[model samples]
Target: MNRRLYRGLREAILEGAIAADTRLPASRDLAAELGIARNTVVHVYSQLLAEGYTRSRQGNGTFVNASLPDSFLSSGRRARLAAAPQPRPALSPRGAAIVDGASASPYQWGAFMPGVPDLTEFPHRKFGRIVSALWRNPPPDLLTYAHGGGLPALREALAQHLALTRSIDCDPEQIIITEGSHQAIDLASRILGDPGEVAWVEDPGYWGARTVLQANGLRIRHLPVDEEGMQVPQEAGGEPPRFIFVTPSHQYPLGPVMSLARRRQLLAVARRHGSWIIEDDYDSEFRFSGRPIASLLGLEPDAPVIYMGTFSKTLYPGLRVGYLVLPRPLVAAFQAAHAELYREGHQMTHAALAAFIADGHYAAHIRRMRMLYGRRRAMLVNLIERRLGADWLHRDASLAGLHLVLTLPPDMDDLRVVEEARARGVLTRPLSRYYADPALRRPGLLLGFACVPEQDIARKFEVLLDSLAEVARKPARAARA
Candidate 1:
């Protein structure tokens, strides 16, 4: 009898017939109605409360548990009801747009996939040892919420390293450690620009940066990029933008080091317009050519440039550690904003990274990977020229960075070719998809050679080349028909 009563009540709750928080009848009234003793009703109600199906208030009557799990209430009948499909709630306009424009690949690591480091080569044993030691004897401060702009030890180490290598003139105080360059960009966009304000981004630029700016409600103005990097607008036709995004060190996808004259000209434009420059120095450490180009921040010490760098390319992406070097005046505001917004904390990892840099392991690892990647880059270029033929596709003369852009015929659909190539197990990003304005986009493929093994490069290129060759033949075949 109790089993029958319990099952019925549970089914009602799970099926939404008896909505959450609905009070059950008094024990006397229920007992009389069901033709059962009052004690029987009390026992059943007590059992329901114990099993978390319902709750009881001392003064008031018993009620159904608002937070009861579906599994707890589900019976033979309720199980069938649970399987019924329900309509999903509508997403906001911005949310829907973000979902529609999603470009992240399902698979991260493979041949020709860009911006991924060789994780197998990472010194995990050394890092693990450091982590183990720190965990065994953890400091009070290390376990607490991080404040006042990242770990001091890591900041100091980074300051020394950046000064020595990138020629960035900044103290530890001016550096704000973040989860990655993505967060650094988000923080900068929020603090620097307001909703509906103008922001300038390179036409065929990093899509990630463009997405961040757009998500912050900033109106993105697509500026064309040439061999000298982003072309600074000479004449002020309209109102100045709040900020300008650039990858000057090694221009993303289509790698072009911004010339000294162009850098000065860009600075002049920014100064005249009173717009801040967001310089993303991602993957600058992997330069295989002449002397490394100094950062724009270093060129003009007092320039309004927020320089960002991430260890994702150099170390591993999972580290989720990156830094932003801001001017002295903007440091406090950024620090406060970072704290209020992100509240980032990875003290142990930061300490380990600091020790790794200070002990020379970080620099040593970079030197090893640089040599490995250089060979890989040359092999890929050689294969493209030899197997694919230079007449059909022109490889961008990029002396640095992990990826190279191969320009296709103006009439070709790079996106369609990329989709077909993915079917053949060769991953490549279509260059046209990176542009904010589709009308201004050029047909090209961004091939990443850094993560691919030396031996696998030949085989992978064969697959990619075949797909591209087939694609090239399509238009000709159509014309002949």
Candidate 2:
């Protein structure tokens, strides 16, 4: 009788039909209900308590343990062990790299994130019309593999757009439509550097590029970024890296436009070193300040530069459209690489996006979003000033991109602040997470304001303020003691 009662309760608890913290029925009442002896129920409860399945609260009744070990609580795991062969960790050189980092909780607060477009303002109707138009009258050539260079019309349109807007003089033949800027980077890495070779990456730069380069097994030399963009080293180091990836247009998370002189110097350095200058013109399209800065590619048209840009930031991520304006010399090589990598052309999407650009709609959309985003950026600055008063961080914040960085107090760890902020229902990231080394860590939060609704900015800021106060108060009170 005792064994039967034990099995029933164990099964219920293990299957989670009876949840943790659920109180068991009274021993005498439960025995009668189950048609068992009262002594049987008592004995079962005692065994459960001893085995940590249940706990007694002295005078109160027995309850399921708030915490249970896996062996006793998970029936599926036990069943799996009984039936199939148990899996073992992989034995490899980079086995540890296969493990994933901790995932962020969704309910966390204060996520001043970056690289997100305002979905609320996405031109769905305009995009929908273009996509539908393409499907209605499909191009037969598009049904087969697209030309390695990409959709001819799209390449020509992109060339014209770059020439007029960015002063980048390029023949459509030299332009290769890529999946995204990341693919372009990967291609450049393969063409220029052998595995285990070196590449210069900006310090406290975009970790996305860092991860990609490292995954390819290339050694990375971290260079510091100043206000004038990636400061060209006074002397090009020996056996200089074959590739140097730079985001000269509003440096990621740092928002510093590269100076014209520095641009020339960078080109000179790359040319002299025989190194490839990988230019990521990611978000230069939406400039609120003065005249748009001509790309480094424009500075030396004949020089070796692998120009890459993405519509992900400008348009939307799901569109998956980006292009590379390669040097005339490397275009054929890249085409061969493209042929090996991509079999089916992304022709339908290419046609739709190309048609959208040709109709003067794409230009208009960029202009409209530029103005709207500028207003939102201004509103954010105003909100911060009005609410925070003099107690704000990063006063000289740049007015570009969908997000900005707010430098934290020198002693206060931004990582700890991010964790505490998450506890209070706000999602945010620390600048340190982006850095390659702890020594290069900047104590600050990377706040992305683009995706977040403008109306909710005040409420979110208030929550952020409250969290900051909590973090600050603890140290202050402790210091006084």
Candidate 3:
């Protein structure tokens, strides 16, 4: 009986039926359940432990050893392991496409990694104090699921902040808190668009939005973006898009603030086509230029625009807090959809964020970071100019945002340069990867300076310059050959 029980348990463990570290049934419990003597179960457990199959913790039950030695298993169990490796489950068509076309970098936070904020500088102590205080005397609703768009206090606080800073015209009722801009985009795409519907995305735009919109079954049209912002197509293609996605305030990677005239043109286009515009106002808070650029939603009252903003860039990315300022007409629909789709929670954090904004910590932090990032940006730009020269690296005229685009020769392969830079501990994103069409792709590098320290910028950038020099030498050597 002991031998039979030991073989069964070992086979179960070896076959992966019982996963590693899974606690086994107590000897007494198993003895009673299986109608076996307690002495038999004890002997089996002792034998298993002696053979390195299980571990007995002091005062705790026996658990399967996480690391199983190949030779420790009996011959009978070894026979089962000799079979061919099982094939992985096949993904759906959409899932397969998403995995194949994924562009997310393995490293998110590093020197010169774009779109990441300086998390080290975050006021964790102050935020912790707020969290601790909330936990001490937490509200009933705070511990429960969020009702109605989100916490009223947070929406009101955000509404006031947006109005003062971005000139957005919105009431607290119009605001809907989201997990992040990604979720906000997903909700907007599904609620506003149907499968096979058209959606216009800015060429060399945010890849994340494109991925989310495409995943929701929207056909994406890449609209060209220049100094003025996303250009409105001269002639209507097959059908007007259900929505158009734009990064109007501090355009992603490129950093072009949408011109007032361009904003009006986009609004006009949206009205003509009866299309909803998703204005992704990412990283607009850290502008180092003139007065803050007004949002497209605020430009024209009742414009068909769904404004999305995230605290990822402003605060820490892990906060998972973002919002959507919807038009009054669409508020009810969005709120209903948000509840149905996301089933939002995180009330405690929402309340804490509201207090943070109300107490003026949010604005104060932004102000301090803006000054620090400005110095870091200037330092990187100076280093690039001094080391690589203006002829080799042409820095784009951008005064806002965390990252800057450095244009290279048209023939240069930015992707190759990016890979070479990565080997030297400098992270960079190639500009060509952002474009939907290969023909329109430009060779450029998106160098992020916000997260990197002002002092470290020169050293890390010098490493990048070395990679650039090597890339430049390759073309010359090939030409001689």
What do the candidate models score in CA lDDT, each in turn?
0.87, 0.78, 0.87
Query: Model 3, residue 262: displacement in angstroms?
Result: 1.1
Tens digit of per-residue lDDT, candidate 2, span 148-242: 76888899889989988999998999998888877777777877678888888887788768766776778888888888888678675655777
Cα misplacement distance, residue 32 of candidate 1 (Å): 43
Best by lDDT: 3
Per-residue lDDT tens digits for candidate 1, residues 128-219, read 88889888999988987888779999999999999999998789999999999889999999998899988888878888888888889988
Q: TM-scores for all candidates? A: 0.83, 0.77, 0.83
TM-score of 2: 0.77
Give the best candidate by TM-score.
Answer: 3
lDDT of 2: 0.78
* Candidate 3 lDDT (Cα, 0 to 1): 0.87
| Candidate 1 ranges with C-alpha deviation above 4 Å | 1-87, 391-396, 473-481
